[model samples]
Target: MMKASDLLVRCLEEEGVEYVFGLPGEELEDLLFSLRESEITFIPVRHEQGAAFMADVHGRLTGEAGVCLATLGPGATNLITGVADAHLDKSPLVAITGQGGRERLHKESHQALDIVHMFEPVVKWNSQITDAETIPESVRKAFKLAEFEKPGATHLEFPEDVADEDVTASVLPTRPRVRRPDPDRDSLTRATDLVEAAESPLVLAGNGAVRTRAARRLRQLVEHVGMPVIATYMGKGAVSDRLDASLLTLNSGPVGEAASAMDRADCVIAVGYDIAEHDPKSWNPDRDKTVIHVDHEPAEVYEHYNPDVELVADISATLDELRERLDSVEGPEWCSGLRERIVEDVSRKPDADEPFSVKRTLPYLREAMADGDVLISDVGSHKMAIARHFPSYEPNTCIISNGLASMGIAVPGGIAADLALETNVVVATGDGGFLMNAAEIETATRLDLGFTIVVFNDDDYGLISEKQVEHTGEQFGTGLTNPDFVTFAESFGIEGHRPETWTAVKSTLEDAIASDEMVLVEIPLA
Candidate 1:
């Protein structure tokens, strides 16, 4: 009879898992040994949070459920932000945690917490394996639900004693992938009628629209109908920003042409749009505009987002069906100059000629990066610039941690992107966001992972400070000091540089991208 931990590893291997990012602990000793002996590579990270973030990005990019492991109590608690990020961002992730024996669970045992219960609010599903025999089904269910539509996070708690229990294990077969049911013809007809009747039917795309299949169909539909498209923060690259119809990202608001287009629109075709990324009220404040919601799942109930036509099906198939129903359509007359103005608004150089300001530096970075290469943004003021100015050509290429929008994801997310895509990854982080997981630089060096980390130093929590200045005419409590980032990178045995001028910035970025090695570039902000 095999031990339950071995059985669990076998189950993971059967699912074709390539990597499990995590930290090690005594409670997970048996499981660690089993994993060490298996074909799956276990990437030991500095913090449990780093492991979870890496898994989150991996799942978001690959569609397979990314896995992470942690010990009980504190280790499991540390995973909350990243797992919650996975849940809210709609990334598929399976988090495994080791626990004390069932005997100690009822009492206030050391390092024991009711993690499964704590995780309920964040994960789609979860369970604790009380009996070793339940491992197969429980593992299967966790992976299944994590990867299912409107995909999110799942969790499994493995009791230490159960992991040590000896038993004959049976491995459940993985279910074959299935396409979602097609949208009803009546729903399509309703959507078609709404599109035909409206004069300016703009497309408001979200993260879901950028799924590879859906992105292709979305581009096709956009061209066929000639509608201007505004992607959400997470949907930056669904339609190529180079195209005339693509209006770049939509957030709370932009002052000029983009806002005008939104206000002028009578119909909004929200494709694979998730409310978690952006509120509909920002665009449809009056709740009077007709909406055609196209996604695999029903829209989340909200007062401002009442869809006149709900086309629930596989996102790609729904777009194909909608396009086939119409011959040609026209967007608002303002669509011609929308992309140019949006680009200009985002790309104008900073005042005082600060070379490394997000607005000034983004164009250099974008010009250096290939269309398919990746850029991961951490939560900070710089992210606003990246969201607005960074032009992405492919889906999942411009990775932003929206929803929970946790800091410290850029570095780990870049690492995961490298592993998942085998492409150059550039991570953009502010001083505040970078320090949150700066220790993970060693993780990248340890794995010999290649990516670029660009740290924008403002010596304060700039985002909050700027808001404070806006409201009160002054900034406070957001100021901070920093060590030399170049030296910090060298300490991790990686190359580092600082570029003072725009020319050097571009050349340095170009060199870094071509080098394909771990490098950090520190840019000072004014």
Candidate 2:
């Protein structure tokens, strides 16, 4: 009998999914058998959470789509963090989980829980497949929803009985829908007029611009119009930091001359920008300005501040049209002066003498990492520092948890890098975040994945501590007395090192890069 699990594998193969990250369980033996018979290479993970993250990175890296699988109950619950991370970041992922027979559902059966509803908000689409013939169609629909307009995760809950049932009906593969966002010509004219009239113009970009392959086009648009570029956290790498007049970072205090100039500018061009994560009050308050918002999605254009003119169009097309419309008008010299001022607002050094200063540490770490090296960062202030200061010479080099902002993503995300790509991978995490996925160190060793894990041992949860300090005048609920991380790594049969100085960090990193085994390097902070 041809089972649903076999049809699921056929559907995955049809969609060009070459790798499957997951853990096998008794409940999913039928699926495992199907996986073994298919062309898809299933990499077993020590934990389901690790499998989920591995799938996330694989999708982020290849641009195809990520796929992950897990057994029923606990395994399904463990994947929530990774699933939510993909959901928040808009990464296209297809997640599958096993369930008990439909008859056992809600009967106090073993390993039975409502996984479909559990993943509802986190996934674009979710459902339970009780009918064997529906497996192929469900798999196809899951991938379709996952790859839809704003790519995100989609899931299918496969019950045990359904996996063994013979499929009397066959469903064929189908291509997913591709969205086309065309720009409004009239909106472009209005935006171009505002740009021509303004003395100082600033371009604030967001992740939306990067999603549409508008990075190079954005740079050309900025350069051609002679406007300074400022990127949100997700938009950090949208414009090259090395490029002249590129003002990306915005720190509190006094708005540097460049940022201050833009803050006070008469015109702010938000290109494919979503101000969800940015502090817009600081950027646009007290200014009599016209905001020309260009976005592929109109909802993104007006979700925050009302735009003077909303250009609902494809980001690349709108920019191209704007270039055509503004050919005769050129920005003034004040724009160049503002860029210099904004650069001054940025902090070149650490604000305080903390043991592991992010300001000072990032530049050193960037130097140690080779060009095209992949850095997977755990969520914290440290990740923000790396995003602002670290230079990625190539695309898709820096992978962080932007969506869902999962803490322990660093380790599993790094493992995914090792599994998918042969490049050197570095996982940087705070002491607190590392503890979340610390057990995955065994997964790394067992797989013999050669990647480096750098634990920023602040001995406290610095992100939460900073928030507490700001809210209460004192830090609370932040400290964590961690065990010896080096000893823990050594116990797992992985090499471990703790560096006391910046020089030692580089030295240990060099050795780790040369090793064919996993290495844990701890950097203790005061």
Candidate 3:
């Protein structure tokens, strides 16, 4: 006979989970003890929020369901933000929370709450395990649902007493892959006809295109059709910016040449485009252009996003079919002039002499990083700067939280990216976002992971301050007095540097990446 906790661990192992990010609590003692003897390494994080953020990034990079654990009450509550982030971002994750004993549920119990109800709105699926015999089934179901098409978060709760009960249950083996259906013939023909008839067509790539093999096919279709490609923040790397067809990234506002291109395009081929990444209302206010929606799922209905034709199926397969159908059509040169204008605009560097100007600093950082290196952006004004200026050569190399648009993800996200990819990770964060998960620096040091954290130290919430100044010509409640970041990094036994010049910043970044040690760099904003 095996303990239910042991069976639970076995189920996780069978699913090929390599790591579990979490914190321990009284309700999880049995599960923790079981994990001790398993091959999966349990990462004890400083905060439950940090653990969940780590899992979120792990899922985004690997396409696996990143697993996170927590206990009841406060522990479960702390995991909420990251779980919600994963849900909105469409990152696969399975969050396990331990609960008070089942016997106490009928009466008033210490640290007992209906966590299933709490998580229902955020997750794709969620369930509470009330019987020892159900542990294997619950674990298997959670992973499957989490990693399915349109992946998002799932939850499984284990009551304390049930975890210790002996059970005769076998861990279920993972199911074999199932082939997704091909696009409907009539829909594909209609989409192809619309593209052929349009004078100017543009591709709007989003987070859904960031999956495996989808980027390559999307780039091929865009290049073959000779249409300009503009990416949402989360879709930054789907097509390499070096391509002549690439128009870099789109921002939240009405500015940029990309917005101009969107305004001129008569037809929009939205490849895996999600409204959550960037609202359709912002770009399609007039709702006059024809849209061909290509995704694993149907187009989300919005007044501004009613597609003329929906190519609903596996994204890669749909692209391949479209390419075959349009093989005879000559590539259009309609957007070539706009693409050239955008290229020229982004290539011109800002005045490097300016004090810590993000526009000037990011190009140098891009030069320092090698191809395939990972860059994680925290939410703030810097996110806007990096998304607009930073050039990514490969998919999944530049990570941004556009779905939930959450702050405090970059530091822990950098740690997880380095762990999972063994690549040098650079975290770009504003000071306000950095402090939210700054304690994860210790977690990174403890794990002996190598990554560089760059804090854009403005001593204020720069984004909000800029907005306030724009709205009312004044700012308040966003300023802060901060410690010397160099000293702060030293306190955690990591290398820290404050570079006074752009040249010095580049050299410091090169040295840190070469050394492969955890480092922190603070550059005060101009």
Candidate 4:
């Protein structure tokens, strides 16, 4: 008879999970042993939260379900942020956590809590597998649910005793892959008519478009119609950056001209469009305009505004149908004007002495990296600064946590970036944001990833503080006087330095990138 813990490992192998991100614990010791013996790579992270975040990145990069493991009580709670992030961002994830025995679930045992209900609201589905015979089935079901339409995280709680119990039942049967939505021909024809009739047509692709694997087909449809396309923040890399039709790709701030251009379009085609990231009141066209939404999941299609034509089908299939029906469109100067506006916006610079001068430093950074650099921005004004100003010639080179907006995400995210690129990794993080996850610096140094980190020291949470000053006329809990991050990095067995002026910043950045050791460059804002 096999232990439930070994069965869990076997099940993971059967499901094609390549990596398990987690921190081992007493309750999960048996499972950890099983993991070590299995072929799956177990990445032990310093914090359970960081482990979950690393899994989040895996899902975003591979379009497959990310797996995370945790122990009872504190372990499960620590993963809340990352789980919630996956839920909100619609990333497929599985969280297997140890819990108090089934007998001690309601009673207070050491490290005991209502594990099932704790994650119920945030996860798509959650369950506790008390019976050894049922462990395989329950976990398999959790996986299936996580991979379902509008993918999200799923939680499964397994007790230490149950995991060590003998399995008397047979292996659980695998569920067939769920089918994608079928295209409605009538709706497709109507959408095609809308596209053909409109002169200045624009397509807005969202994160859903990227998740659905429709980027290639979306590009084909754009080329077929010869129309310009704009992307939501999470949709930044939906199409290749070097493509002619892609214009003004950034996550936030006023996309005034791009919004105006979208409004001018007689028809707006939204592909796998999820409206969570966009400002509802200001974005999109007037009520009189037509909207054709093509989404793989029907729920996402009508989550916000109702479309004139909603086609529930695979995004690529719908785009192919539209491409076959609609004639080649030539919009005189619509795309050209949008391109010019982007160029103008790129040229816009901040005034001297502004504390938030990260934007001003972008052109030099872009020139320094050229096309090979992989830039990861931490959550803050600095992220917006890089998005608005820094240029990228390739897709997926500019990494961001658009879904979670978790400050201090850059260190771990940058580590992942280094893993992917194996060279030329740069992290631009703000002073306040860096403190939130500065501990990861040690992880990078131990692994010898040696990526360059540029700390933009504004001495405050510039984004929130700036907004509060403007709106409330009072400063709150946003300001800070940072210690020497350079010394901090040096203590962790890494090289550290600070640049005093703009010229120093340029020189330091160039030198840091050239170094073989991990380098930290702290720049004082204003």
Candidate 5:
């Protein structure tokens, strides 16, 4: 017989888990001890929220269920933001929380709460383990649900006493194979019919297209049919930005060449589109466009998003089938002009005098980084700038939180990217968002991971300030006071730089990357 915590760790090993992120607590002592004897690495983070964010980004990058741990009550509550982020962002994550003994659960136990019920609304599935016999099954089900289609967060609460109990239960072996259903023949044929009949066709890609093999297949379909492709913010790298067929990323408000292309197109083919990324009302205002939806599941019903034909199946398989059905048809000549216009719109250089603008900083940052290097953006005005100006060459390399749009993701997310991909990461965040989870910088230093962080020091919640000024012709309650980031980084044993000129930004970034140490660069706006 073995301890329940030992069996739980064994179960995680069976699922091929490599790491677990969390904070150390008395309630988690047994599990932490078990982790010491196992092959899995336990990453001790400064905060539960930072741990969850790390897991969230790990899941997004690796296509596996990233695991995060916490104690009961406050610890579990602190993890809610990142859990919600993983849920809406469609990343697979398993959140484990330690509770007090089951005996005390009947009373007002210290640090005990109904975490299972609290997590129900945000997770795909949740359970509280009250018996040692349920350890293996609970863990198996949590991973299965978390990594399944339309992946999101799953939760399992283990009471301290239950974790200390001995049991004969063994881990269940994983299923060898799980098959995704194919697109219905009638639906595929109808979708093809709609595409072939239309004079002008456009493709709108979303977060769902960011899956492992989906981007390549989608690119093949776009290239074969010679259609203009527009990506939602989450789908920025679904196709290479350098491709002539690629239109740049779209924002919440439809504008620029992309909006013009959408307006002129007779038919819209939505490939793996998720309305959560951007509302259809913003892009499809009239609800009159003939939309052929191709995704793993049926489109969510909305007044502006009712699809004329839905090919619900595996996205890559559906794209392959669509390509096989279509004959070589010459794309419209107007598509060339639209692509040219989009390229021109995004390629213009900022004036040298505008040293403080994001437009000026982004180009230099891009120049300093390689094509496949990872860039993460926190939710703020800087996020908008990165999404609009940064060009991505590959999928999952340019990370941003669109569905949840959670602040404080960039630093933790950059750490995860560096860990999972073994690549250099550059995180851009506004000053307001940076302070939210700044303690994670020490966590990165402990792990000896090197990444560059650039703080856009506007000393305010720039997005809110912009909106306020736009709406009421004045701003209020968005300003902030900040520390000297250079000195702050020095305190953590990481080098820091403050560049006063736009031209110096690129060289500073290059130096940081060459130093092979984590560095922070603060750019104070004029």
Candidate 6:
């Protein structure tokens, strides 16, 4: 027999949890001790939100469900943003929160706020642990649901009493691997017929296509039949931007070169496309184009997104099955010019003497980073530019939050990406977003992690400011101030560089990526 906390930790080990990012508290002291005696490394963070964001990105990069923990009430409340971000982005995550003793849960209690109830809307499943014997099944279920099809966040609330219980429960054995259902025969045949007959057939890939096997078959489908492809922001690297069949990443909803491709195409093969990333209403406002929806589940109900052929099964298998049915097909005639126009809009190099802008910096950043390097973008005006201009050559390399579109993810996400991938990570964040979780710098530095944080110092909330200007012809309540960024970095015991010229920006990024320590490069935007 052992303590329930120990059993809980063992259950986590069985699920292959290597790290648990969280902040410690009084209520969950037993669990913390249990973690110490186990092999799983507990990563304590400055803020619960940062811990949650770290878990969020780790899940997105690795297929496993990233785990996070916190105490009740305030701590659990702090994690809502990142958990919600994971839910909307479809990243698998399992969040755990500690509560008061079971006796006081029904009455007034310290640090108690019905966390299980609060997390209802954001997670797929959530339950409070009342019995020690239930730990094994609870942990297994949390992981299973979070990592399965249409993956998202799940939650568990462990009361203080439950953690101290003595239980003889053993960790559950790993279950047999069950393969996902294959695409239906008739639906797939109909999909092939549409692709074969349509004058212009396009593949609209999303976040779901970035998985290794799915992305491989997607590229094969594009090659076997000369199909045009347009990726949503989160799906940037689903297909290599270098391919002739690639049009461009879908930036804004109804504008730009990518939208033009949607207009020209007669059939849209939405392989692994999630409506939350880029709503079908944006591309199919007219609801006229035939959409061949291929995903793990049936399409979400929407007037504009009605699919002609719903291939509800394994995405990689569906793509391969569809590829086998079609002969050589032709791409849209407008592919060459559409790609060129998209490239020309953002690839121009600004003279060092000219003012800095998001457009000017991307081409240089693209050149500095290798095709395999990872870039996790925090939401702001810069994200729109990165989505539009930055060309990703590999899947899961360029990460973006299109569903929740959360800010302040860049820093925490960078830390998680570095740990998860065991490689140096780069983050693109604006001034507004950087401050949201800026304290994570201490967390990253303490962990001895190597990464580059490129802060676009605009001294304002640029995304909101730009929108306000477009509507009212002026910006209000959008402007803000900042300290000297270089000085700020020095205070944190890390190197920070503020580049005044385009040449300095180019050299700083290259040098930072080469270094084996944390570095911040601040580019002042005009």
Question: Each model's TM-score?
Answer: 0.97, 0.90, 0.97, 0.90, 0.97, 0.98
Residue 453 in candidate 4, Cα distance off native in Å? 2.8
**Cα-based RMSD of candidate 6:** 1.5
Candidate 2 clash pair list: 89-403, 257-341, 258-338, 258-341, 258-342, 259-342
- Model 6, 218-286: lDDT tens digits are 999898888889999888888888887877687522247788888888899997788888878878889
Of the two candidates 3 and 6, the one with more favorable TM-score, higher being better, is 6
> Candidate 2 residues 334-426, lDDT tens each?
555655543443434344434666646665566667766788889987777666656554446677566567787888888778877878888
lDDT of each: 0.88, 0.75, 0.87, 0.75, 0.86, 0.88
Query: What's the CA error at residue 393 for candidate 4, in Å?
Result: 4.4
Instruction: Report the C-alpha lDDT of model 1 over 397-471, residue by residue, as the tens digit.
Output: 998988899999999898889898877889999999999999988888888888899999999999999999999
lDDT for model 4, please: 0.75
Candidate 3, residue 2: Cα displacement in angstroms equals: 0.1
What is the per-residue lDDT of model 5 for residues 1-526, given as tens digits with 9 covering 90 to 100? Answer: 9999999999999999998999988899999999999999999998899999999999988889899999999999999889989999989999999999888898886777888899999999999998889888898888888887678899999889999999999888887435468899999889889889888888898888885449999889888988878888888789888887787677412246677778777788898788998898877898879999988678998999999999878888898999999865557466677667656655555665665866568767877788878898999998887787677778887888988899999899988888888677898999998999999999999999999998999989999999999999999999899999999989999988998766677689788765668999998887
Model 5 vs. true fold: TM = 0.97
> Which of 2 and 3 is the better model by TM-score?
3
Worst 10 residues of 1 by lDDT: 250-259
Residue pairs with clashing backbones, model 5: none
Q: Which runs in model 5 stand beyond 4 Å of their true positions?
A: 252-255, 329-332
Better of 2 and 5 by TM-score: 5
The clash count for each model shown is 0, 6, 0, 0, 0, 0
| Residue 6 local lDDT, model 5 | 96
